[model samples]
Target: MIVYILNVIIMALGLYCLIAKRHIIKKIIGMVLIEYSMNLFLILIGYRINGLAPILLPEMNRVQFSQYGVDPLPQALVLTSIVIGLGTLALMAAYAMKLYEKYRTFDMSEIRRLRG
Candidate 1:
């Protein structure tokens, strides 16, 4: 419950940053926060209280394992997502550096402001 609330709060803050901030780096940070929050939510949704791992041993009853075991799919999905997110963040950071080199500023508004 508390974890869910914290995830929501973090997501909200990230959204706020993405919507209200002008800096490219800040927007990237916001995107990271949102991604992390979503990953956490997925993991939490698949979690069971007092649950054991989904691994099956030869001695364990299949029915009992099915009933008490935790879901492993979400965990796998989150791991993939984290890897993708890291690659995306690295790409975004590289773009930011390129943008800074061309524009001499990190502020998105200032870099793209209308010239009149």
Candidate 2:
């Protein structure tokens, strides 16, 4: 229950950062925060009570395996998500550098080219 609330708070903060901040760098940080919060939420969703690793021991029966093991899917998804996030972060950082180079300031409102 507490974990859920924490996740919500994290997500809200990210959204606020994106909406309230006028700095491109801060918006990028908010994007990262949103990604992290989603990953955390995914991990918590996959959590099992008294869960053990999903390793199949030689002596363990199917019944025991089902009862003791945690779901491996979310863990795998989180790992993939982390890698993707790193790539995205790198991309965002590169974009931020370019924006800084062109605009000479981090403020979003001053970047007139972005407006449609």
Candidate 3:
């Protein structure tokens, strides 16, 4: 619904920042934004109105649980993606720091020009 559209808009803004920004830090921020929006989208996909957690209890019938439970797969996937994204973000920050140490600037264009 509208939430999906908003998610797409956020992702587009991240793409714009990644493509149009000159600063390395800004690009890293953009990457993180895109990662977060994707995680949100995955969570939204598994959401259900009036849904309960996908847990089974002695009183709950199998049919009712199947009909009412929100999906757990997407949630698991998002969790995995978050961990992977954190690792990627850390690697990117390390590279940025090294670039700054060498070039004295976070501007990507300047870094390219200074390459020897």
Which residue pairs show backbone clashes in model 2? none
- Candidate 3 lDDT over 1-116, as tens digits, reads 99999999999999999999999989999999999999999999999999989879999889988998999999888889999999999999999999999889998878877545
TM-score, per-candidate, Cα-based: 0.86, 0.88, 0.91
Model 2, 1-116: lDDT tens per residue? 99899898999999999999998888998999999999999888888999888888888888978987888999998999999999999998998899899889988878877844
In candidate 3, list every pair of residues with a backbone clash: none
Write the candidate numbers in order of decreasing lDDT. Answer: 3, 1, 2
Residue 69 miss distance in model 1 (angstroms) = 1.1
Error of 2 at 25 (Å): 1.4
Q: Model 2: runs farther than 4 Å from truth?
A: 57-62, 113-116
- What's the TM for model 2? 0.88
Sort order, TM-score high to low: 3, 2, 1
- Kindly indicate the candidate among 2 and 3 with the higher TM-score: 3
